[model samples]
Target: MNRRQMTFIILVNALVSLLIVLLVTWIVELRRPDPEELAALYTPAPAVLLAPTVTVPVETLPVVGGDAQATPDTGTTQAEGDETVYVVQAGDSLLGVAARFGVTIDDLVQTNNLANPDFVFSGQRLIIPATGQTASPNATTQPAAPGEPQIVAVESAGNLADEAVLIVNESDNPASLAGWRLEREGGPTYTFGNVQLFAGSSIRVYSTSGEDNTIALYWGQLDPVWRAGAVVRLLDGDGVEMMRQVIP
Candidate 1:
């Protein structure tokens, strides 16, 4: 072979070898994965769990003076401006409530505007005036006329032996109770005989049997004549109603 041809053959073989090495390096670089992509494939996502919803309940209270049904011995009191609101319990009377709150019957009557001072019912709401507070002017019950007799109180009315009705004579002149009748509606009647209730004096007529006296008289009844929620009327000899009171 010639010297020039041998040189040409060596040059061509070196160029082919260089081309093969560059092709192999490009193929290896294309197959290799990126750092961020490799980490995303192996690492797991964070777990998420939802919680359930919840509910609650609420309580309600009875409004004052709204409910008319009375509970026995169960009463509620609330303070108002310059006064107090009291709920009347079963078997409560005007006298008993007045004595309990250290107020007078006139105070209760004027504040509540009661048409009849002798009548009070359970579940009634009464506004008690504060100390030194003036009574309301909207009173429904007027004071008795001068020189008039009145029924003041009825105490322990449901009790057989302890029940009594009080009668007061506010007249300037002496009052006669003779031939008068004490009637219990739908029940019994008691008649007075030769009795004289003097002016500015009081007397108690008891339900149970006992001897007649100056300050007290007996009905001679075996059972209780005056019960809770009973209407007692005082009638004259001419069958006229002088005064009336309700047992509490």
Candidate 2:
């Protein structure tokens, strides 16, 4: 071959080899993905922790989770602010009378001291104690007029500061405060769900089973209530109040 022809041949051969190399590289790239690729884009986030819920420690379960409570009854029947007294009339059995009024037998007996359930005489005025709302056997002193029911005030107080309030019963009524509720207002009437009383409250005797039982109540810093002229009444089962004392 001539020199010029040989040179031309070498250049053509180099160009062809370069093209072949590129084509092979492209073919090798056309492959299926690997089965085990690491997950890099979407990593999971950690879970967050929260504080436990605060509940009232009373006889019944704490029912104040966003529940609108206007009045405070430690397990009394008196609706928000209603109270009354009933007289034991003729033809009244303890069970029959209690059932008619929608109150427990124990509550009726506690309100009215019946030494002998069978021995109650006619026309003996007795306290019928308060409940949510139900019929009565002729109640006396309705709230505003002759037909309206009386409104009784129930005061509940608790401490934001951790401290136990000593309880004393005025009427000696048997009360269990395993599931109760309390609210406290601080810095602009803010209410907080609470467990027990703050520091001090008026303790009185509870009239339970013909006996006087005392209980501890924690309202708040006792001094603030006493200064505010608040009143707390310890009532009997018959709705007859045993004692009414200014918070002191």
Candidate 3:
């Protein structure tokens, strides 16, 4: 072969080799996944934690008059001179009756000389020592005018700062939160101050540090206060439970 022909042949061979190398590199790159896509394929899915739920506690009243349809009655007694006679009714617990009449359970037991507080039963008569107290705190005053405040929602599965309970006032007038309390089954009691809410209003109470505002209240707890399978009780000024919520 001539020198020019040999040079031309070498150039063609070199060009072909370069083209083949580029084609191979392109194919390899096409088959391989990008860094983000590779991470998505190999990385595990994030764990999902669910929030807790709330339900009301169960309470059963007594069946009275031997009638299946008759409702149980906790007989109300009027003051006669120095003492009042109270007839125990179904669901007429000592703690409940005392709270209703603004008296302590201890007072009821001591005056009646009862061995146990739970000894009282349906149709049993109890003598209440009168101190000129005629009005019942639970009867005279209520949670709110139109209706009591309700627990609308709650977030109990997060950190202390994120834990919260939402309450709404469905009353006609402004509802005063004075002397109101929020109690947990196995936790501390959170008392409400002089805060008031208007009709059709809502407020959020947190477990962490925050100033008490019109729409929010803080428990100022350092650790997480709410947990799973807990019951939240809302009590009025008379210490009577207005509502209850159970966590799941």
Candidate 4:
């Protein structure tokens, strides 16, 4: 119980207390979570995979009639053997089609068996008859002889209101046009009613709906009956072709 003995006892107690505090701090550090391991557990993963991009090319169609240039407003034409085939385009009339191929309207109607000669739709195939070829079995009319009434000229402006055909009587006597027929090839026909043409006198036939007179006769047509290159025929009362003139 002396002073030296008491000092030694206090030193031994302090050493034991210090050893216990170090052991507690070491145990707490081992139980705490690591920063790298906690970040890996909370990170998000992707939901879907990305797809690859692709491209495709378009195709084009070839033109008809081989290398023939397309005509403006008019359709294209192709030759097959000795015949010419014309494909109808948009805004094509039967009169215009006949004129373009230099064929008569009756030739078109008889060759194609057209139920309605005034109606021709787009993309329709038309077989053009050759020049001087007969249309039907009953088309036996011949051209007019000399010293008869002749179709002198055709003034066609591509409109029904302004289209006209001129006929002149070159004989010495006055000829009667009564019961005479003015035919538009395969289209409607205009018959004269009690009309007379004097010697060396001329008359005009219009292709429009109007009152008829001595000099000018109207065909009463809704559309134009004449076009460029169309054939205009003048027939007698017996269905004989008196004159044939092509529109310019």
TM-score of 4: 0.41
Error of 4 at 75 (Å): 43
In candidate 1, list every pair of residues with a backbone clash.
Answer: none
TM-scores for the candidates? 0.43, 0.21, 0.41, 0.41
| Reference-based lDDT, residue 97, model 2 | 49
RMSD of 3: 23.7
lDDT of 1 by residue, 132-207 (tens): 2211222122233456565665666667787777676766688888888888877899998888877556677899
Full-model lDDT, candidate 1:
0.72
Model 2, which residues run further than 4 Å from truth? 1-82, 132-248
Worst 10 residues of 4 by lDDT: 132-141
For 28-85, candidate 2 gives per-residue lDDT tens digits of 7766444454355456798888989999877855667677565632222432445555
lDDT winner: 4
CA RMSD, predictions in order: 20.6, 22.2, 23.7, 16.6
Best-performing candidate as measured by TM-score: 1
Q: Please, what are the lDDT tens digits per residue for candidate 4 over residues 1-248?
A: 99999999999999899999999999999999998999989868868887877767777566787896655544566666767778888877776566455455567898889999878898888888765221221233344677777665455436677777767676778888888898778877889888888876667788887888777888788888876556678888888887775555
Candidate 3 has an lDDT of 0.71
**TM-score computed on alpha carbons, candidate 1:** 0.43
**In model 4, what are the clashing residue pairs, if there are any?**
106-186
lDDT of each: 0.72, 0.39, 0.71, 0.72
